[model samples]
Target: MPKEWFKRVYVCTKPFMFMVFLQTSYAVKNLVVKSALNKGLNHYIFAVYRNAIAALFFGPLAFFLERKVRPKMTISIFLKIMLLGLLEYVFGILYCYFKNGSEKKTLNTERIT
Candidate 1:
């Protein structure tokens, strides 16, 4: 019974083993990224690199895996994506500026009193 149980546990398909490995690697990568952020790595640069690397890895997989069903990148779609990205960037900058500005004001008041 123990031997049968062992075989059952160990007899995973290749795709199952690959998924387990992928998830473990992703968890470890997140831990390392969090450690780097805590250590004061430049977050903007980190975000850029993270997004670029993700695109680099996933782009090919998407191209190959979904080539048959992937929707075409029309000019309208491209323009919409660009516009959305620009809006997000502008909003992020505004939010950060306001957030930091408030924090600075509080910090300065605390220092004064």
Candidate 2:
């Protein structure tokens, strides 16, 4: 029947649509950051504020949504999350270092000329 055909098409396109939406979000985020940076936003402060806002938004949802079923925090779990956060920040630092270093070079050259 046409209903079955429509259901099959919807199921097949669901993941493809989700991926397109996700990619569009990432592209938009990058575009916004690039525009802000060009307008003199400090990357370090931007990174901190971005992370802080994300935590503030998601932390409560996580705490409330999973509170009933979540396991108690153990030291090992705490340490593992800490280590993972540290690793993520380390990559952020490396990315900022290389990116800002290149930008600085261009800035210095512009000043000299």
Candidate 3:
């Protein structure tokens, strides 16, 4: 019974565990970036290195895993994807303009401590 209960708990907690892992990773990234900047690393250079590292890690996974099951891009699907991306920024801009434009303030990024 305990073994079955453990398996159920693992399945239920998988997503929450992943969420915590991602949040922890971002926190570490921020700390490392701040430290590198303090030690004279250019932000742009750091960004390039970060992207390169990510590509190195995920590029193989994408190529191998998605090569078989990837969907073909269609014009309508492309436009829908682009629109979905723009909607977030458009709404954000409108909200910032309407909400705090007078004060020149916006919540572009939330710094969580």
Candidate 4:
């Protein structure tokens, strides 16, 4: 297979692949939210917890799969991964906190009447 052909194929397929990914992700998110509501769980917690579970499950698989193709890891690589994980956790917490805080404010305003 020629390199140019590969590039053309990739360029043509990229949008379709992205669209499929977006649609699938949207559907999964809706299902998770609905299921959590039915189970009496808060939607924010459900979504965040679901994402954490997914990361836990896939994180190791990603490392294992990438190891076959990537260079051997060094201390710097480990540090970078740690930093990325820390950022992920911080952002996740901030998002959930803001969401829950706003929700509480709305509920409190309704109660004030």
Say which candidate scores most in TM-score.
Answer: 3
Each prediction's TM-score versus the true structure: 0.45, 0.60, 0.62, 0.42
Rate residue 8 of model 3 by lDDT: 100
Q: How many residue pairs clash in each candidate?
A: 0, 0, 0, 0
lDDT tens digits by residue: candidate 4, 1-113: 69999999999999999999999999998997787799899878877988999999999999898878986889999999999999998887668657877534533533233
Question: Order of all candidates by lDDT, from best down to worst?
Answer: 3, 2, 1, 4
Off by over 4 Å in 3: 71-113
Q: Considering every candidate listed, which one attains the maximal lDDT? A: 3
Looking at model 2, residue 15 earns an lDDT score of 99
Report how far residue 83 has shifted in candidate 1, in Å. Answer: 0.5
Q: For residues 16-69, could you state the per-residue lDDT of candidate 2 as single tens digits?
A: 999999999999999999999999999999999899999999999998999999
lDDT of 3 by residue, 1-113 (tens): 99999999999999999999999999998999899999999989998999999999999989998997988899998999999999999887878767874424565654445
lDDT of 1 by residue, 1-113 (tens): 99998788778566799899999999999998999999999999899999999999999999899999967999999999999999998887668657877534533533233
lDDT per prediction? 0.85, 0.88, 0.89, 0.84
What alpha-carbon RMSD in Å does predicted model 1 have with respect to the real structure?
Answer: 8.0
Root-mean-square deviation of every model? 8.0, 8.4, 8.6, 8.6
